[model samples]
Target: MINQLSWKVGGQQGEGIESTGEIFSIALNRLGYYLYGYRHFSSRIKGGHTNNKIRVSTTQTLSVSDDLDILVAFDQETIDVNYKELHDKGIIIADAKFNPQRPEDTNAKLYAVPFTDIATELGTSLMKNMVAVGASCAVLNLDIEVFKDVVQEIFGRKGEQVVQKNMDAIKAGYDYMKEELGDQVGAMQLEKGDGKKRLFMIGNDAIALGALAGGCRFMAAYPITPASEIMEYLIKKLPTVGGTVIQTEDEIAACTMAIGANYGGIRAMTASAGPGLSLKMEAIGLAGITETPVVIVDTQRGGPSTGLPTKQEQSDLMAMIYGTHGEIPKIVMAPSTVEEAFYDAAEAFNLAEEYQCPVILLTDLQLSLGKQTVEPLDYSKVEIRRGKLVTEDLPATDSYFKRYEVTEDGISPRVIPGMKGGIHHVTGVEHDETGKPSESAANRIAQMDKRMRKIKNVRFKTPVHKNVKHEQADLLIVGFNSTRGVIEEAMTRLEQDGIKVNHAHVRLIHPFPTNEMLPLIQSAKKVVVVENNATGQLANIMKMNVGHIDKIKSILKYDGNPFLPHEIHSQCKELF
Candidate 1:
């Protein structure tokens, strides 16, 4: 029996390809198998090729498998597009309608089942996805009953008859496949899992949940690809806690509205992808100068303009760091995993309030949208620390409340509007301690220095996550965001091949974490920064901050796809 296997479902964009893969993976996840899933689709709403590839393992895995074991297809285009990723022993289950053809170049097996015919006979043709899921179950020798929970949850509201029809489709497909393959049906059975409970969700789900737990009472955002889910999730759950979400007319309105909420004493946030982030930059700079605490999530997608909206790319690294005109202090954080996304998203509010500036939570398209099995998040770990926020009534003085006072640590006492004796000017222009606009050079210098110095003692858990196997290593693989898993998998393979490899994933991006990363770079004979950008932005950031430019190299991919383990491993091997 195999310990792990890769399964994929492909079809037209609006054809329920995603639902089929979701049902299959969720049932397996219920059995406690660790799963990682990635989706490839077009930017439009429908009519393009789309697919969901899932890697299921007895042990935990981070990235998509390098090769596919089974391909479930609705049409020949699915096979024509994705056949090359299959191994020689791979299997393809397709609908008999298309009379699918297997290319002569590959030895992978093909089975044409009557998916549409069976689903139509059961009541609706839409249940073809359920039929496909059952055929997959037969090939893996998995019990069809494992899908009961998911099926009930999805179709139970439609009434008992609808639910039974879907179940019948699955049973019919499974029995048909089992009868044809006979004993061979169990050939690809996966090893049994530990049967532990876990959460199967995407990074956006984690971020939204974390935001709610962190006391974020208001979210104002315009919907955008990848980032829209954060807003969508909050729309449903925020009201349970007396919070709310606003889908503003534009990104500018979203950012400004969130700023207005924070100014009124609520923990407010906004989220968007690259294009929206671009539109929100001026407003972000406004938050910086006004010293308003706001958390913004930048889900990085492929971009310059609207380039590859549904693809993966980290080209926003430099923009996030220095996007706004004329420097004002800001914090940018990158969370490499879904768990970190949750925790970091929660902590972002604290950081924004403590530092009295805008905090950006950064994520690539892959990490933002990829679905995976996650351990139960501990709500006890989420702590809300609104720094220097003066909740108590201020003294009954007539003077402005020294809102932007230049203290030793640069963080001044903060109070919301209408607080007793808390009246002060607020604007984007240069301002003095009382927040009034000022043209004096001395006052300008002081306020600017204070804003910049607030981050000098930034509070963060870990700036860089290190998986070090050697004190001194032949190679150091450095990355940020979603590259963490793929790098870990590559590190394991390289270590087994006798290459001393270490990993450093930057969790905090703005402050650069030079002190933590410098030693690792110095110890290794060579350093390669792997990022999903054309120009190797992360490498340049390291070189500029940590130095050792000669030893630093970059492995870059901007092809709108995430790096696979084999791709990373082979590239690092070549460095030897």
Candidate 2:
């Protein structure tokens, strides 16, 4: 019995390709199989090649598998475009309607199944995905009954007959494939899974859930690819917890609205991708100077303009770190895993309030959208820390309150607008202790110094996710966001080939984790900073903050796809 399998389903966009993969992965996740899923789609609503590749294993796995074991194709184009990724013994289950032809050099087996015919005969063509799923079950020797619960949950609302028809469609496809393959019916049977329950979700789902759990009462965002899911999730769940989501007119409005909400003593946030982040830069500067606690989620994608809206890239490192005009204190966090995305998202609110500045929770296209199985979250681990925020009514004062009082720690006392003795000015211009506009040179210097010093003692936990296998490693591999899993898989393969490797994934990008990263860099003979950007932004950041220019190198990929494990392994081998 195989312990792992790589399967994919492909078709035109808006044809239930995503739902197919979701149903399949969800069932496997229920059985305790670890799964990692990635989707390939164009930047359109429909009529383009799209596919979802999922890797299922008994043990936990992070990256997509290097090769395909099975490909379920709806159209000839699906087989044509994705066949090269299949292994020699891989199988292709293509719909008979397309009469799919296998490419000459491809060694994978091709089975022309009547997916559409079976679904149409049962009820509707929309159930073609269910037929394909059944054919996949036959190939993997998985029981057709495994899909019963998921199908019911999906189609149960339609009626009892509809649910029965879908189930029948699955059974028909399974039986037809089973009879055709005879001896090979169980050829690819998988080893039994632990059957333990786990949470299956995308990073955006985790982030939204984390936000709600973290006491975020208001969300203002403009919908954009990848990042829109965060706001959408909040839109549904926030109201149940007495919170709400506002779809603002533009990214600028979204950001400023969030800042306003935060100033009113509510945890609020805005989310956007590259273009939207660009629009929110000026507003971010406002939050920085005004010391208004706000959380901003920057889901990074390929770009300078509206580049690769549905693809992967991590080019926003520098822009996110220092995009707004004039330097002001800001915190940028990059969460590598879905689990970290959750905890970091929740902690972002605390950090913003504690430091009284804007905190940007950074993610890449893959990390933001890729679906995977995650261990249950520990709600107890989430703690809300509102530093120096005065909640109680203070003694009424004749003079304006010192809302921005400079202190040794730089974090000033905060109060809601209606609080007694809290009537003070708030503006974007340079201000003194009372937040009044000021042009005094001394006041400007003091205010700048205070805001800058606020993050000097940031209480962030595990700024760098470290896996130091060796006290002194020959090479150090560094990455952030979705690259963490791929790098770990590559390190395992490199170790098997007799090379020592250590990994460091940056969680905190701004107020860089210099102290923690210094020793890791010093202990390694060489370093490779892998990222999805062509400019090696992360590598340069390491050099600028930690300063080990001689040993540091980069493994970059900016072709609108996340890094595969073998790609990383092959590149690192060249450095040695």
Candidate 3:
């Protein structure tokens, strides 16, 4: 019995390839199988190669496998580009119309089927994806009732006749596969689990839900790839909760609008990728100087300047942490899992409000766009904490309130706009206690210290070190963001091979967590920083925080793909 397997579908853009993978994954998830899915596509909309890969396992998996166990190819180009990634005994289901041939070097088997022809005969060519799904289910010996139920839910709104026709197409595909291939196709049967339900979502959806759960009432954004889905999701769901979403003219407008909404006493956020973040930098600096608490999500993509818009990278580490002009104490939080992405979003608002400073949530395309089977988040545990909010009645005064008042912890009680005794200056320029422009040297030093001091006072309890191995590890691996899963998996495999390796994953990037990280790195015999950027951005940040920069080795990947666990293991093997 197969405990795990990987299935993939490849075809031209807009051909329902994604839908096919989704249907298969949902059915597998219903049977309590863990899933990790990824998609590869181009910048163009149509007539280009696109594929969806889903890995199913009885055990929890968050990273993609290096080889495919089954591949469904819609065209000859699909086989040409993908056959090398298939395992030795892998099976390829190709469309008979394409007449696909296996590569000369591979030992995998290829079976041709009339996927499109059968669907067209059933009244709609769109059912072709369902046909592929049905054939795959037959091959895996999966109960067809689950697939039929999912189809009914998805297509029931269209009409009864449409749903019936699709069901006929599924039967045709399944019968064809069974009759032609016989017992050979049913050789690999996946073992079923305890059938406990789990939530399946991408990181963006989790963040959007977390925002709603955290009481975020406003969002403004200019649409951009990868990051646009966060805004799009909020647009549909926010109105139901009495929240508002606006598509601003540009990223600058988005950032400023979110800041303005926050000034009016609401939790507001804006999201964008690398290019949009660059446009929002000046506005972010304004939020910093004015001490407006707002959350900005940077769903990072490959870039020097729109470098690879749809690709994944952890390259924004330096840009997110140090990109803004002038000195500002901003918090940067990176969530490693889809579930963590939700909690991180909720915590981001709390941190921003507590310190009255902007918080940047740094996420990569892999974590932002990739789908995973995550456990349901406990909403009761989600604490809504708005720090330093003064709700008591303060009598109106002619002199404006002390908005930026320097106190013991450098955090002054904050009042919203139009509130009594709360009308104060809101500007990009540095201001004094009464919220007026000031050039006094003492005033400048005191204000700077006050704003800077709030970083440590953040209510967010950040872990300085995690995933540390006991019994004196042989090496230490340090990474952030999407690399967490693969790095942790690699550490496990290395341990099995008698290598004692520990890992330190930093959730809070800004204050750098110097005290907790310094001793860990100092004690390790060897240290490696794995990130997606070409230059070792995380390593440099570690150097700046701790003095032993030279001791840290850097393993980086910038080719717009995430690191596979085996790749991490192979790279670490060379180090030994």
Candidate 4:
């Protein structure tokens, strides 16, 4: 049996709902508890309702459940809105002033803690979230020392006075919970893991680190919602590693500058969200036509335009596949988790260089902001695949350097601008295999075929779909990007109910793993395709490639929210 606990903190957007959940997660992590957290809020700053959900367990957790184990309502609206979601045996901690009417049959324990009254009495409402944190600890029999340590770690740099006041507020709430909730609270202990571990990191930071590891020396980007964090992280970390991160004036400029840097012989990258990606499409085509090795990371958010800047969605699948005006062969890939993001970024750079093409790392808001702990990366094992640029040992010959020399593997030797006697012309018009402007129909078709063939060649060399529990299941669930963790968790739950299931996560999106995936899907009795996009892009692609649409099931969502394990389990049950 799996033991699960979920907490919801609801209040105005800026009233520390997100901070309260974050602090709880930090404390829980210290206790060796695995956690899954999700946040929801209006796009406004002041009055709209905001909620943060946190799921914690002694065992690993991947998704936040819909049911609440504990509900901390900061205002009357919160109590009114979320009381129905509380479990029958759950607990509700709320302000005393707003007495909510509870059903007679409701089994949830209710405690009125006077949160605002206590904060007002303490002479500052800013400590309200800390009060809630302390109260939660008291009622759950959690270690107060953990909360204290987190406080110090979070606010120690601010000053002594701020720390003291927050601690005082915490103590006040703790005292109140002790007096009211009494010994009914339960104790939770966790088993310690083996000493080998990795520092926790978010997906955006992982992507940035991976790019650095891949020898990306220059990055240019314009600030956009979900993708902005990638730039923020790279800007601070790149300088120390002898790299540069520039904030360009616009998305077009950012992409162009990255292209320029790539042309100058450095591995360069740029990142943006949906709107910015649209703006950079022409430049993306430019990179494609010129066969410059450049990486573009698009951290997708909900949009056709700026539909939802701060929410999660997978609507950009088609955009990444066919965004440019003309037919341009570009490699597109997605990483399923924070750890995968690091490796995928490095691999993306390598693919761009190997194929002399632009590569897109497709990520979404869920992966961009979600946090997780993973095994420490073995940097020694990392292989940097630089392009065919000539270094110290190689010399330019008297014959003119052909930028697009036809080779067996469809990859040409690349010589950058500074290399002596290696200067060559590149243009957007149809070009022959020798990289010159051409209008000949045969040359155009050959050029297009050559570009497409390069990606096809990479499909064989790229990593295949990752399958979990491959040999022991009849039902196969396939997913990509951030849907990986939740689907894995769902498969575990389904197994408990005597339903065997396996999972195949595709990391490379374009020029997909047709050879491996076809056989895997064929082996399964039923195939369930899960994605955050509404149209089930991956499922459709699988059908187009393998010709087995009849056996595949699609579980698609586009609500600007991610699927919980319970939801996926329910869908599987219905299908069975």
For residues 1-576, write the lDDT of model 2, one tens digit per residue: 899999999999999999999989999999889999999999999889999999999999888988999999999999999899999989999999988999998999999999998999987999999888888889888988888898899989999899889889888889888887888987778898899999989999999999998989999999999899999999999999899999999999999999999999999999999999999999999999999999999999989799899999999999998899998899999999899999999999999999999999999989899998899999999999999999898897799889899999999999988998789999999998998999999999999999999998788999999999999998999999999999999999999989999999999999899999999999999999999999999999999988989899999999999999999999999987
Q: Which segments of candidate 4 are over 4 A away from where they belong?
A: 1-4, 97-106, 187-198, 393-399, 459-465, 468-473
Instruction: Please write out the lDDT profile of model 4 over residues 1-576, one tens digit for every residue.
Output: 235578788988888888888888777776666666777777676778888888776666556676887888887688677777787877888877567555465677778888877887887877888888888877666656767777887889988777777888888888888888666655222334333334556788999999989889899999888887889988988899899999999999999999999988888999999999999999999998888989999898887698887788887877888889887778889887787788888888888887888899999888887776655787775577775666653365775567776666667788877677676677877776656788999877777776667777574243455655656466889988788778887888888888778788887778777887887788788899988877888898889878788999899888888887888889987877
Q: What lDDT tens digits, residue by residue, belong to model 3 across residues 340-398?
A: 89989998898889889899998999999899999868998788888999887689778
TM-score of every candidate relative to the true structure = 0.99, 0.99, 0.98, 0.93
> Model 3 misses residue 174 by how many Å?
1.6
Q: What tens digits encode model 1's per-residue C-alpha lDDT throughout 177-246?
A: 8987887897689999889999999999999999999999999999999899999999999999999999
Looking at model 2, which ten-residue stretch has the lowest summed lDDT?
179-188
Let me know the TM-score candidate 2 reaches against the reference structure: 0.99
365, model 1: CA deviation in Å? 1.0
Local lDDT at 295 for model 2: 96
Q: Where is model 3 poorest over a 10-residue stretch in terms of lDDT?
A: 456-465
- Model 4 steric clash pairs: none
Against the unseen true structure, what C-alpha lDDT does each candidate score? Answer: 0.93, 0.93, 0.87, 0.80
Could you list the CA RMSD of all candidates, in the order they appear? Answer: 0.8, 0.8, 1.3, 2.6
Compute the lDDT of residue 296 as modeled in candidate 3.
97
lDDT of model 4, residue 536: 86
Superposed Cα deviation of residue 140, candidate 3 (Å): 0.9
Residue 427, candidate 4: Cα error in Å is 1.8
- Ranking 2 against 4 by lDDT, winner: 2
Q: How far is candidate 3 from the true structure (C-alpha RMSD, Å)?
A: 1.3
